[model samples]
Target: MNEQTKKQYTMAVLNLLQPKIASLVKEAHPVYQEDLEQELKLKMLEKMQTPFLHNIPSFFEFVSSNEKK
Candidate 1:
């Protein structure tokens, strides 16, 4: 299969499997409720932007490479 066709097929399979996988995860991990909530909170905090941020050249370089491709 071509690259585009393979990508489409993979996305279709992931869409079909996502709900089933989520259900299984929920059933199997009924014990990590507090940990999950804490982890989610940490992720939210990490994503917050502060006013005193410095410019990172490496991050900009990575983004430029992706845009070129």
Candidate 2:
């Protein structure tokens, strides 16, 4: 992805994770809390770069895939 798209994607994911990250850092030592939050955000952004799926499955497609166990 281009730089602009990549940055936007990172920001969106980080925004979604902000609350969870805050909670996670809350229990950390006061001196380490900021560092812990930064590390968590960095890790999440790194993982998001990995490919997940190119497209979402439609209802019929999902049904067919799940049929016959």
Candidate 3:
């Protein structure tokens, strides 16, 4: 992808993660929230960059399932 498209894709993923990120922050201890948030962002970006798509879950779906636990 071009630089602009890559950035747009990243931002789109980030936007989709906002609500889940907020939920995770509230669910986590305040002291660890920043670290957890950063980790989640890294994970989301990593998942986005991967080319394979055989059994991968949608980002929000994964977040929702995690939220349930």
Candidate 4:
């Protein structure tokens, strides 16, 4: 794949991880809700250089791939 495609893939992976990561952070450090939310927002924005896909394959590809491995 091209560089842009690779970046998109990485961002897609990060986007998939955001909720789990944020939850882990919150669980580990319960007092940091505001900071964790802010950081998660920034990280999500960084991943979402393009608008996110609402369609099925684009949204679920990462999760499905993980399950297969």
User: What lDDT does each candidate get?
Assistant: 0.57, 0.84, 0.86, 0.71
Q: How much does candidate 3 score in TM-score?
A: 0.68
The TM-score ranking, best first, is 3, 2, 4, 1
Higher-lDDT candidate of 1 and 4: 4
Model 1 earns a TM-score of 0.39
Q: Model 4, 40: alpha-carbon shift in Å?
A: 12
Best-to-worst order by lDDT is 3, 2, 4, 1
lDDT tens per residue, model 2, 1-69: 588987897898799889989999999999999899989988887777667632567889989989946
Model 2 stretches astray by more than 4 angstroms: 52-69
| TM-score of model 4 vs. true structure | 0.42
TM, every model: 0.39, 0.67, 0.68, 0.42
Compared with the true structure, what per-residue lDDT tens digits does model 4 show for residues 8-68?
8777877788778777677756678778776876776675555454333654897888899
Q: Which prediction has the highest TM-score against the true structure?
A: 3
Count of clashing residue pairs in every prediction: 0, 0, 0, 0
Task: Please provide, for model 1 over 7-29, each residue's C-alpha lDDT reduced to its tens digit, 9 standing for 90 to 100.
Answer: 58656755675565555556556
Off by over 4 Å in 3: 53-69
Models, CA RMSD each: 11.9, 3.6, 10.8, 10.5
